[model samples]
Target: MLLYGSTDSGHSYKIRAFLLLTASPHAYQWIDLALPQSHRLAAFVAASKFGEVPVLLDQGQAMCQSNAILMYLAQRVGKLAGAETEWQGVLEWLSWESNRIGFSLPNLRYALRWSAQPPEVLHYLRQRVLADLARLDAAVSAQDFLLPSGPSIADLSCSAYLFWLDQVGIDESAYPHLQRWLARLRALPHWQHPDLAMQAVAPDTSLARDE
Candidate 1:
């Protein structure tokens, strides 16, 4: 198996963490997006139609999208997202995360780190982020994970971008339940910080550049 991904990508980190947590055998190649050479790679470009990172090349097949890869790998291992009883709930949260957190917080993070924008634009994104976090807070407040069964790919998908909340000027104190849930995830075995997990694969010079 080969993974073509960027070191700073949360989407890439989700797949990397799953593979590592499961002790899956694979080789990872870091893509330096900063280099023009990266975009010109014929094989990678062919594998990823959208020119995105975290493309998992398994058995001569290319799997795109982080959530899809997470679900595929989890189901293959009979863990993470394997419980039939909670499968629908897991899928629901996965869809929700893609539609909700995947857009808002990561957008905010990107804006905060890499883009210059008007105060109004930042404010608008922050509002969206707060609303999404509130939804997650309400869901996980009285439970251990999103589905009430346990942590699944849903939790991994949702929490990926959140590992950088403080870095993006989002106050964790504002959402206590969300913070608690994050803490629980941090305490889990084989839980590596996103940057740390990325580094474990292979260092890319791009890691030093904030985005």
Candidate 2:
């Protein structure tokens, strides 16, 4: 399998991190998005459908979307998404990532893009981020993970985003449960390390100044 992604992209990092953590021997080709060079390539678009990074090629078939790919590979290796009793728990958390965790993403990128913008303009994002942190904090408070006792695709889907959220100066301290959950995730043996995702983002002015 070959993965085409950028190290600076969290969406891509999620996929690469999983492959590495699982010790999956796959070839990775870094696609630079510095100028939208490869993104418009016909071959890439055809393979990835939407020409998105972190595209995975498995058995001559192309799969796009990081979460989808994660689910595919996890099942490929026999890792079940949830226990019999917690099936809906698994579904809910993953769905939450699609919208809830997703809202914080664009705001983060916008902050990185317009770092020179006024604090007032970024205030909305800060509020949104704080709200997300609160929601996630409450959700994970009772369980060691999204599920009560085990890690699943839900956790993997959320791991990279949460790591990036904290690094970007979201004031994780405001959410103690989130901080503790992050610490617990960091200690897991099969945990996917989020180095480039963390590195891809810098602490923005909101995190540095207002913080």
Candidate 3:
């Protein structure tokens, strides 16, 4: 299996974490978004319909989108996919994450780290992020994971970008339950920090940062 991704992308990190947690055998290729499209690997360019990273190639088949890849991996490995009855809940949480926390947190991080946004825009993103964090904290307060079954792809998807809370200037300490959940995830066997998991060839520093 071959995975194409970028080190700085939380979306990419989601797959990396899942692969590590499952101890799946695979090779990772770091795609430099800074380079011109023509300069990128032809296989990656052809595989990524949206010109995005976190694309997975296995047995001559290609998969795109982070959440989709997660679901595929979960089903393939028979782990982290949750029980048959809980599949709907898992899907719900994944959808929620994609629309809510997944959207706000990454955008806020980009605005802060890659490019500066207008004050009003930043404020809007921050408010959305805070609200999403509160929702997550409340959801996991009573349960050990997002679903009753246990840690599913939902948890992995939602928690992916959160490891970089400090980079985006969010005080992770403020969200106690969330922090605890993160700790639980960190304790999982074979878990590695995104930086270490996704590390690869350095990209050109002169180009604009990826979202």
lDDT of each: 0.81, 0.67, 0.89
lDDT of 2 at 9: 66
Error of 3 at 140 (Å): 0.5
Query: What C-alpha lDDT, on a 0 to 100 scale, does residue 162 get in candidate 2?
Result: 66
Which candidate, 1 or 2, has the higher lDDT? 1
TM-score between candidate 3 and the true structure? 0.93
* Model 2, span 1-211: residue lDDT tens: 6676765566777677666667766766665566565545455566767766878877778888878888787777656466767767776776787676666655565575645557775776667777777887897888777787576767766656666664466666778887888787677665555564323333233322110
The estimated TM-scores of all candidates read: 0.89, 0.78, 0.93
Clashing pairs in 2: none
In candidate 3, which residue pairs get closer than 3 Å at backbone N, Cα or C atoms, i.e. clash? none
Highest-scoring model, lDDT: 3
Q: Indicate whether candidate 2 or candidate 3 has the larger TM-score.
A: 3
RMSD of each: 5.1, 8.9, 5.4
lDDT of 3 by residue, 1-211 (tens): 7788997898999998888898877777899888999999898899898999889887678889999999999998899999999999988988999999999999999999899999999999999999999999999999999988888899999999999999878888899999999999999999988888878855334321221
Q: Is candidate 1 or candidate 2 better by TM-score?
A: 1
Candidate 3 weakest ten by summed lDDT: 202-211
Once model 2 is optimally superposed onto the true structure by TM-score, how far is the C-alpha of residue 92 displaced, in angstroms? 1.8
lDDT of 1 at 66: 91
lDDT of 1 by residue, 1-211 (tens): 6777776799998888787767776776677766675555576788886788888877667889998998888887777884678888888888888888888888788888888789998898889898998998888888988877687788899999888888778787789999999998888888889887776445344432211
